[model samples]
Target: MTSRVRLGSLIAMLAVAASGCSTELPGSAIAAEPSATPAISDARSGEVFGDLKACDLLEPTTTPKGFAAPEIERYESDNGCAAQKRGYASVSIYLVPEAGIDQLSPGQGTKIPTKVGGREAVEIPGDSGTEACTVAIAVTPNARMTASTSLNEGTNEEACALARELAVAAEPKLPRVG
Candidate 1:
């Protein structure tokens, strides 16, 4: 009789425990409903430069004073170009389709908020022992164009000025961003 009572008690406890367990499969959904958040894609960002090469934005004949005619070179893979003046300075331009001015990485430099042709821009002065600066101009909320200048015998300020000038000249050719 004692053994029977123990077995009954054990079965009752197991029954109570099983009442709180769930029988749903791993991938089974609790409800058939759509998600609240929508999926994101490139089209949702805004307009982007479609086949607009960076090299076509600037003219090789129109360069800053004291610099030779820019030797334009287009990037093989990415949408970028370099207009280099041998032994003096080189201005490289890039079009980032999925990035903004805020997303730019100011590597080893002081970031200064500025403007390029009335558009929001950020200028990064080169760090110590370097003679280069970069200016990134906002094209859209998800896109940007950047101009980086490297001067062989110029100060950081000069480099930044050159970079800003290059960005200003190229901003008009880029797609207007609202």
Candidate 2:
């Protein structure tokens, strides 16, 4: 009798386990849709590296009455970042071309190469003219990710990172023209 009870219990347990493994669950019928678009695709962001190939240097807007606008330069990238000399500073913008984002960096502003060239070059503070800044939007590969960065003294490194995030979060992507 004891042996029979044990065997009965074992069989019941096996039956329950088997039932759980059966394909009766609705989840089993559902298939993954490859066509589903990702929320972070290149079209959603102002990325210049991927689907968005270029960005025009728009005029910098005015800052508040008391505060001044940092010098900014509108830059666009094709395959990679391009370098330019402005006074004592250098601005660069990098593009992934596939992802659609642009990465920006502004170096110390220096003087232009000239004939006499005896005048000393000056470094513009990060807070100078609006044209003194360089912005970049960077896009990663299949991720279609976009990001941006600005170089201003008031903008901390963390702030710059956030700016990049904001760039990635911008809008539909296009191509670089100018």
Candidate 3:
């Protein structure tokens, strides 16, 4: 598992605040380093990507049109995967057996139940009226796929919509074994 501090720092870096333009992590900002080889190797089970280190789950070749590929980066198993697209939206998809520290779409904004890939899901804004949103989808009884983002590239609704779309796109690629 990735250290809580590292995961926290990574997630923190993506957090959007009510202050705007000043997204700050809880601790010092940790620069993303080369992650060609992810820390957790056994987690590799995605039907499409095969492994997390490949970072192909959300690549341009895998995603739909208009949505550019992100430079997938991670700290370890704990950090999952994250990317802040240069021209597209900044997003993170944290696959978790349990929830811990997540700065993106922090807490529960406004809970709006919805469906993704024929599965029940919930969309929550980072905060009421904020330009950030998150979608939490259950992958199993003890696991979930959390897609989150801060709307630096679009409106609040768009961010939430993107989150849902990303989740739908990611569902098929997820590991069946997990």
Whose TM-score is greatest here? Answer: 1
Show how many residue pairs clash in every candidate, following the order shown: 0, 40, 1
In model 3, the runs with Cα more than 4 Å from the true position are 1-54, 61-79, 99-108, 127-129, 175-178
Q: 51, model 3: CA deviation in Å?
A: 5.2
Q: Any runs in candidate 2 off by more than 4 Å, and if so which? A: 1-51, 56-94, 98-146, 155-158, 161-170, 174-178
Ranking by lDDT: 1, 3, 2
lDDT string for model 3 (35-129, tens) is 76544333333322233432454554224444445555553235355666556666777666443223223454767777777666678876434
Q: lDDT score, residue 20, model 3?
A: 63
Whose lDDT is higher: candidate 1's or candidate 3's? Answer: 1
Model 1 scores a TM of 0.65
Estimate every model's Cα lDDT from 0 to 1.
Answer: 0.75, 0.33, 0.59
Clashing pairs in 3: 2-78
Q: What lDDT does candidate 1 reach at residue 116?
A: 85
**Tens digits of lDDT, candidate 2, 1-178:** 9999999999999999988795455645668777554444444344333343322211111121122323333333232222222322222323434432112223443222211122111122232334332223322332222223333433334433433333333322423222
